[model samples]
Target: MQMHKNRPKNEKHSRTVMIRILTCIRPHTALVALSLLLSVITVVLTLYIPILTGHGVDQIIGKENVDFKELSAVIITILACIAVTSVCQWFMNHINNKITYRVVKDLRICAFNRLQVLPLSYVDSHSSGDLISRVITDIDQFSDGLLLGFTQLFTGVITIVGTILFMLSINPYITLVVVVLSPLSFLIANFISKRTFAMFKKQSEARGELTGFTNEMLGGIKVVQAFGHQDEAQEQFEEINRRLSGYSMRATFFSSITNPATRFMYSVIYAGVAIAGCFAVVRGMLTVGQLSSFLSYTSQYTKPFNDITGVITEFQNSLASAARVFELIDQPSIAEDKAGAVRLQNPEGHVTMEHVSFSYVPEVPLIENLNLEAGCGQRIAIVGPTGCGKTTLINLLMRFYDVNSGIITVDGQNITDITRHSLRAAYGMVLQETWLKAASIRDNIAYGRPNASEDDIIRAAKEAHAHSFIMRMPDGYDTVIAEGGSNLSQGQKQLLCIARVMLCLPPMLILDEATSSIDTMTEIRIQKAFEKMMEGRTSFVVAHRLSTIKSADMILVMDKGHIIEQGVHEELLKKGGFYARLYNSQFSAV
Candidate 1:
């Protein structure tokens, strides 16, 4: 498995980002085209008003008196134009919002589905909070940005093009002034966009960090309060929040300057065109009606500059968000079951690991040249000190990770050749740490075998000695558990987890310090339950408590990834080797 110590940087090209975003919109092409067409129609109606007003002033108004008829006609025409423009604008927004949200929805779903199939190694190394932020927070930002960008960019382009044509028809000199000042707006937008993009990227990252820290702290809130870390946690969160606020302010500060800077240029050119128009009228080079029309057209032409710049300024933030979502989607998934892979059906539960070698990191080998065999219904107990590759071996057996070399086989068939679904289904596991959902006791127990009958679920709970305590809850099996099963004691949570595995009824079982959280009294009941459950199933019991595994058919004593001794407890103690020493030391400490 490839592991990255550092998070990947958002380095997607702007063109790549735009293309991906466009591709998302491509599915709703017909709706998008209609929205753009409405934008054009809206612009046309708007431009028509200026034309009718210009004509009324030039031909119908007398110098000494106002022409109410022509003025009324122009006013009526402008009002009609506004009514149609508003309707078109509303419908266009409706379409754009639909298209934008649909695209973001699809993006979020794809990213989430990808997470389900991603390698456990990657999931393990990454922060859940940051991943959640990317899935929810970043995608929402992308949608907002896209919606705004689409509305502005579409109308901005059409408005600029239409206004320029009208202004040129009235007077080219005034149009020239607008054209010349236009680049300054873009230049300012361009400069500010580059700076804001970087600032906002950092801001998004800071938000993710803050989110990750909060999630981590909340998940372990009990420990935090147990040690009185409330103030420390608050202070740390404030530091991150403060840093995020600074980035946010800086990004806002840079982006906020864009509109005002462009509008300042617009103001300069607006006055310049009006002043130059006055001179033109006095020189008889342009008429009063024409100059008036030209001034109106100049404002229209320059208004797009404001919008386009504003869109450009805000678009950078969306681009930053898009880059984050796409980066997550682009990670490689774990290899699927091989072609022609066989399903692991009912078996006698013979398992073997031949010449197995593995390392979490390439430079550091944790297990080397390991070989093991267990026949059907054999009970193998694996005992070792911490970090001795005990759990790592179990991880391989479950195919959570593949070995660096050699073969893991069941019933003489290589596990790699078995469909992972069926291969994993053959084994039931109860781990050291119990994980329960915020669900009812029944649902939590049924999680292992969703189709299990109610009687079976209850039976499994009874076998794990959880049914009596469960009945005392307000709703018995229907009683809802809190997150991480916090509503139940640690032993109660473990019992539910064990009940879950018991319901699976697989040919093989894994008890990886499964009773670690249970008190001595409950542990005795659970161990008895394990005996009945493992009657005809091969079981690998990983435990530190030597007493628990004293009756295991074969005890494999391990140190530094190598099994140094194998026998029943008495035989191993009689050898007086490393296993004997460990047993003595563990007992002496107790």
Candidate 2:
């Protein structure tokens, strides 16, 4: 009952995806029209071959009275038609290939562009591997399906229609027999197509899950090995693999049934046509040559039905994959900047948050009614227990996630009133998780300030205490870093990240465990460099180490999303509150 009720919606969605796919082809209309013309020419010329064969046979009318001259003319015409048909078919296929690949290229670009504008929340909720599968694997499947449709589908339809017309002209009674049996083949194909589509859809989803799970496990394989969870991971992988295998088998099994079932009906149609034509010939209503032509038409008509049924499996799979790709392209993107929004210029670094409230999940409140103020050039440090919203606060200030209520302002102007690009441009940030591209050391340091000269890049590297080690490498500044910086040590990667921030030297700074990965001696040098850079900039430092922020102008101790304590480090210790307890515990542990 549920399946029957949902069928219309499923069909509607399939039609919508198909329409979108066609729109991508609209740009190449001239080529498509050419392909169509070729299909019509090809089908018409091929259909003429059967009539010529009948004429050639009629000319043979008993061996002694045979008209060899007429027979030779008919045979020559048939051969000429065959050659022309082959050429047109080749051109048609070439055009189809061109159109199919171009559409696939357009789809990939659209999906990738949509990914850039989509909100971070969407990315966070979906697996990276799953998204990759949609953009790459799904698009490839759609390409194959579309190419098959173009190459065979158009020619097949033309053949079917042309055969019916030719048969009617030859003998209406025999054409009736062929037409009646045609619906039986269609019914069989329709029933199987529905089942195959459902199965193929599930199979595509399972394939995505398998890709995601494999990516996740491989990315964290070191951790899995460290924790000795290889066995458990293997078990999980096998489970997903089995599910994918089952879905693929069922889909293939159902699609395979389509060809045989439809072929049986087509065979019945051919037999009916033959029996009817034989009777017509005996009644002197049709010539033996005409009966021969009618039989050839019957075969010609049924040939397309067989070819089309064979292509149904691929077409169904293509539609299923297109639905997935369109789903990604149709996702809601992040809201655009408000109209008349002003860009922050020469910001004074004065930041304030008043009665701000936010939570990742609505039911679970993380931060509520938070109020704080930082004066110009003040170095404010935030310390909190794990899951106490330390990072969430940074996210709010960066506008990566907006607050639920209240206002956050920079330079006495609401941040929301400021363009996100300009607001973010005013701040330099360094997080514990350092990211480096597959580029030279010089390029990595100059990422934030891409136009920085060679001298400036070197100066920034020296300030972050990374110049000495960088020079030791074979290529020095030109040394290329591997993806994810796996070729560099943890401390070296962190130093390069710090060098990036130093080069930018924005008006405000947000350092979240910025020096967590460095050695003690290098960290001391980096801190001095940080102090020099933060001299006139408002800096917000989030740290777990109690000693790093001792010289901070104000230290905020947060718990359960609220600022439970705020003062200079010395004053906070003297007050014997949450700050003192957290500080003392860390000192004692060391």
Candidate 3:
């Protein structure tokens, strides 16, 4: 009952996905038309061969009656037709491959570009493995299905139509027998395909789930081993993998029924046509040569049905994968810059947040009515416990996430009114979670200022205290960083990130535990270098190590998303309030 109920919905979804896939092929309309034309030529030439063979048979009634001259001409003409058909089929396949791959390439580029503009929140909520599966694995499956459809579908239809016409001309009674039995094959195929589509959809989703689970475990394998949870992680992975296998088996089972079921019906049609044609020949209504041609036409007519039915599994999987891909590309992108939005130019490094309210989830409040100001060239330090909205504040300032109810401005201009590119360009940032591309150390340092001179890059590296370690490597400045910087120590990676920011020297700075990985001595040296860099730029530093921020022009003590206390180092210590207690707790041992 449930299977019957879902048939209409499944059919509708399949239709929609196919329509979208066709739109991708629209740019190659000329190729498609050419393919159709070639299909007609190929089918017509191939179908004509059987007629020539029948005629050749008629010419050789017996040894004494045989016409060798006519028989030789028919044989040559048959060979010519076969040769032309093969050439046309080859050309048709080449065009299909070209169109299919081009569409797949376009889809991949669109998905990747969509990722660039997707809001950070969406990335936070979706698993990276699932996204990767859609882009890579699913697209490859779609390409295979599309190529098969193009290769088989055009010629299949033409052959079926051409064979039916040729058969009707040969013997109407045998053709009628073939046509009557053909519908049963289609009915059987239709029933199985409807069920298979739903199964394949579930299978695709399970594959994505398994991918996400595997990715999560691998990314955190170190943590899992350190905590002695290898058994638990493996058990969870096995569970997801088992589920995926079950879905795949069920989808395959249903789809596999389609081909054999249709073939059985096609065999019956062939038997029926053969019997009817033999009776007609016995009744003097058909010739022996004509009966042979009718039999060949019957096989040709049913071959298309068998071929189309055989590809139903692949076609369903492709449609399922296409749905997932389209879903991602259609997701609402991040807000675009407003009309006539101004670009932030020569920013004065004065930033202000007024009455800002924000929450990652609506029911759970995080930050509320937050107000703060940083004067030009002032260094403001933000200190708070974990999950106390310290990073969220920085996100708001940089427009990574917009505030719900209030405005954040840079140099008195609302950040929302400024183009995000130019607004973010005004600040240099180094966060605790460092990111480095797989490129030379020189390129990593010059990431922010790609055109910076070699001397400038070396100076920034020296300032970040990374030059000495870099020089020891085999390629010095040209040493290529590995993917994820696995070849470098955590401290070395952080240093390169800092050097990147140093090279930029933007008007504003954000340091979120920027020096946390380095040892105390190097951190002290880097802090001194940071001081020189911040001499004339407003800097916002979020740190858990309170000792590093003592010289900040103003210190903000935050708790529960509000500023509980704000003062200079001397004044905050004298007051013995939240700021004093936090400061004392860190340096009390000293």
Clashes found in each candidate (C-alpha, N, C closer than 3 A): 0, 0, 0
C-alpha TM-score for every candidate:
0.93, 0.95, 0.98
- For lDDT, candidate 1 versus 3, the one ahead is 3
Identify the runs in model 1 with alpha carbons over 4 angstroms from their true place. Answer: 1-12, 55-66, 230-239, 285-287
Q: For model 3, how does the per-residue alpha-carbon lDDT over 229-267 read when each residue is reduced to its tens digit?
A: 999988988888888888889889988888788888888
Q: List the residue pairs that clash in candidate 2.
A: none
lDDT agreement of model 1 with the native? 0.89
Ranking by TM-score: 3, 2, 1
Tens-digit per-residue lDDT, 1-590, candidate 2: 98688777777877887798888889999999999999999999988888888888788889599999998899889889999999998889999999999889888999999999888888899898899999999999999999988888888999999999988889887788888879988888888887777778888888888899999988888999999999999999999999999989999998999888887887898888888888888999888888888888888898898888878888889999989999999899877888899999999999999999998899999999999999999999999899899999999999988899999999899999999999999999999888999999999999999999999999999999999999999899999999889889989999999999999999999999999999899889999999998999999999998899999999999999999999999999999999999999988856
Give the clashing residue pairs of candidate 3, or none. none
Q: Give the backbone clash total of model 1.
A: 0
